[model samples]
Target: MKAMEWYFPKSREELAELLKEEGALIHAGGTAIKEERIKSAKRVIDISSLPLNYVKKDGNIWHIGATATLNRVIDSLESDHFLVKALKCTATTPLRNRITMGGSVYLSPLWSNLMGPLLALEAEIEVLGRRQGTCKYEELLSDRGKFQGCAVTEVRFPDVKLIGWFDRFARTSTDYSALTVTIALSVEGESIRDAKVVVTGSKKVYDRLSGVEKALQGSRLEDVDVEGISRNVNVEFTDKPAGSGAYLAEVSKVLLCRGLNALGSAR
Candidate 1:
């Protein structure tokens, strides 16, 4: 392994200049870099020196800087942010303190705990650098190539009546979920007026579950049929970490069912 040269840019201007290099990687909380498979990455742009580390409610949207840690996000929000709550279930305290929003978005690894929740939240990302790009939550989860050469400066979400539910199907508490689901529901008179179902931890990363959302939109909680859910829902495992596809499929269905059922019970 070669000794690496680190670049800590104190401003976006400097960071932007550093990105002109061919093999540079953005280092935010540095936890992901701490696990870097490569000894030398041309340059590690230490964004912690930059000014992208704050959370604020601006008008009707929550603007979150990329350097903000998972724990910071959880601590910063007072009102129950379903997305944050779901992410809190991802890792232990110390690990959460280092894993970053920007790092996660860039990595989008197989077992990402934040992806499903972010998908369900309908989050929007603001990127900086040579080329700028904006992608909807679903688009980001679906096509990662769109993010090439982009630096995530901020992520924003509109304020709404957000109800979030998360379930991690794991052998134990600390284990990563074999399958995880995050549900955001907006209901009126026990019928879902708007719903986002983010199912992750399978091979493909996540499913937006538009079909399920459409079915849920006008139906009351009591009318949400579990049998229909088992039949209607479909997600192909892009990468099956857990063995037995059929078994995991059943487990995924059960976890999603319970999560949705919990949302109904809360009403």
Candidate 2:
């Protein structure tokens, strides 16, 4: 094997040019890429100098630069926000400080803690390269090819008030979760207007519980059948650190029930 080449692109235009080369991978925090085999790439494009590190609120939107670290996100959002809860539950302080939001979102790692919350929150991202435009969180995740040769500039999240919940099941606090769940409920008075249940660290990578959401819609908190609705969620998992697919699914239901109960209690 030959030595890998490296380029530092200070601007998006330069970054695009560098990305045109085959086997050229963007380096944000490099946490995910570093762990993978170097044979996967021939060149590395460092984007640290790019102006992509920021966290600002623009009216009803929250703009987070791609290079913003998990720690940065936690600091930017309110303590009660589901995003903050997810980030805080991800890893230990040191690792959390090193993991970049862009890297997390772009890679969409199987053990990702960011995906569930971001998906549930309906976040969008700015991409520059082969795809130079904004894409919905679901679209980007479902079709990763759209992200190839692209640099994720930033992630945009809506500024909305809602009751949220997040849960993760791992052997230890630092261990990769066997399963992760995030729920964001828009409760208008006594009725549940909107509900989103997103789960990751499963065979499907991540999924939104539409069936459960529909069941909860228009239903009062006290009328919710947390156990039955949770059981309806069908999640599959490959060989995971925690347990078998069946075991994880069972655990997921338990977590779902707990999360829903917690959300109801908040009201």
Could you tell me every candidate's TM-score relative to the true structure? 0.90, 0.93
- Report the lDDT of model 2 for residue 120: 86
lDDT of each: 0.75, 0.84
Candidate 1, residues 208-263, lDDT tens digits: the string is 78888888888887678856875887766543545466777777788788887887
| Candidate 1 root-mean-square deviation in Å | 2.3
Off by over 4 Å in 1: 1-3, 34-38, 238-241
TM-score result, candidate 1: 0.90
The C-alpha RMSD in Å for every predicted model, in order, reads 2.3, 1.9
Residues 28-52, model 2: lDDT tens digits: 7877766465676778888888988
lDDT, candidate 2, equals: 0.84
Runs in model 2 deviating more than 4 A are 1-4, 35-41
Model 1 lDDT, residue 105, Cα: 72
